[model samples]
Target: MFTKSILTAAALAVALPFAANANDGQAMQAATLNVDASAFTTNELAQIAAERGDTRKAERAARIQAQKTEVPGVTNAGRDMQAAILNLDPANFTTNELAQIDAETSALAKAERIEKILDEKSGATVSTSGVKSLTVEYVHHGRDDA
Candidate 1:
């Protein structure tokens, strides 16, 4: 029993540094993301936001769902967001404040979409074709213009 225990400890000691070094090499490789919000319906935007762990987007998605026609997956995203937000501290925010946050969120989503396009065009390995459609829409509609 004593010899087996010693062998196990010795094997673990030898393996630990190699495992750690292997992880270090993996850490150097970057994974790319491509986002195209224009092609994404409101529900998709909400789903992306929720998957990315943005609680505010989830909450806003629920609100949008309430105001608009139902879409299949959006309700789930909204529910996830609501459940996450339930633990947050309650504070009364003015309508203007809420609007400002919503605007910021929308802008960030747009920026991410743009960034994805630029990154992919710049030779990012992860590619999604929706970015091209979004770029065209942005060019034509000028959705983000002040």
Candidate 2:
């Protein structure tokens, strides 16, 4: 009886740690599930989606979240300036030129500024298809451009 009791105690001692670890994992999973999806970065959302085996859905959710949470101080003037900056080829411009581009307020201004900078840098006149459409739309049947 004493031998059986000792064996049982040993088995319990070994099993307790495994049970505790399992509970810890479950608690962590619960905490993860409770977090706001909008707060997650794109990469983090992608990883979580990959873990859940639903890459497409996660990617779509991430895109939606990104659109909803526009970067601070960024504007959607003329085009998505943030996206344009992200897609811009850094190798094509010097640091000063890039900084100049970043300083521009509107997308149309940025494009025009970039063209001028490139022209000056290369010592060649770069023809820019400038401001294709009217940037401002006046409401209440009135318009003024001073």
Candidate 3:
């Protein structure tokens, strides 16, 4: 499960590349699970995942978690699904999390209309820890990383 940091790290490393390369202008499968991070809700998440053709186990679990938590719990559950498409790196996701992403996020959900971050200028590398910041240069064609 992705709740574990080590597993998530390993999974994401492998999933990111796949996701990044999967877009063939296929209308960019929207992240229906793409929460506002502010308005994300338990029932909404479960319903979205279900509409996206995800398994019942995923929706059930999310529902349960939502009922128990005060914040409706938002984890990187769909990291794998996203990685296999948007990230070009599967290692960026975990085993279970990937499943959740696939189960949740939908096409209409992705229709929230986000401003495009296109072109080389859209790429940025900023890593910060506490008051420390680290910079590294990497190439992102939005399709592949070099």
Candidate 4:
């Protein structure tokens, strides 16, 4: 409906200048159809109408053709769900730890694997003085189950 109105307004705008210059009295009478020239897209037309001291038409036309925008396919719910699924927090762990967690195939298996690792002995200390064998001290704050 709005599109048809715009097309009609455009066609009238195209023919208006010639119509205004006609010499016949009938043409002069036709010119007084009471339609304003500036009634096309954008607020520019409304601005023109206002400058010509027709505030009522300017406001009316402004309301009719106000700008509206929307993303083509993305709904608010879809966007929110995507955000929630991808929202991984890494504040408590290092990048290596995060990579280890990400390598798990399933959530239940991942949790079980982490639990088994945490249950093992970690951060065991050995005396370094006169030691023939090297003692590798592994400080495990969390699981290293990559």
Worst 10-residue stretch by lDDT in candidate 3? 112-121
Candidate 4 or 2, higher TM-score: 2
Estimate TM-scores for all models: 0.21, 0.29, 0.19, 0.20
lDDT scores of the candidates, listed in order: 0.42, 0.54, 0.40, 0.42
Root-mean-square deviation of every model: 18.6, 19.0, 21.9, 27.4
Quick one: best TM-score, which candidate? 2
> Candidate 2, which segments miss by more than 4 Å at Cα?
1-86, 127-146
Q: Of models 2 and 3, which has the larger lDDT?
A: 2
Q: Per-residue CA lDDT of candidate 1, range 34-121, in tens?
A: 3333334544454545554446545655554444443322335433343234221112222222222334344446445445534544
Best to worst by TM-score, what's the order? 2, 1, 4, 3
Against the true structure, candidate 4 has what lDDT?
0.42
Q: Residue-pair clashes per candidate, as listed?
A: 0, 0, 37, 0
Model 1 spans with C-alpha error above 4 angstroms = 31-146
Model 2 local distance difference test score: 0.54
- Residues 33-107, model 2: lDDT tens digits: 443544654455544545553566556555545544544234444234433543454444444345567788776
Candidates 3 and 4, the one with greater lDDT: 4
Which 10-residue window of candidate 4 scores lowest in summed lDDT?
126-135
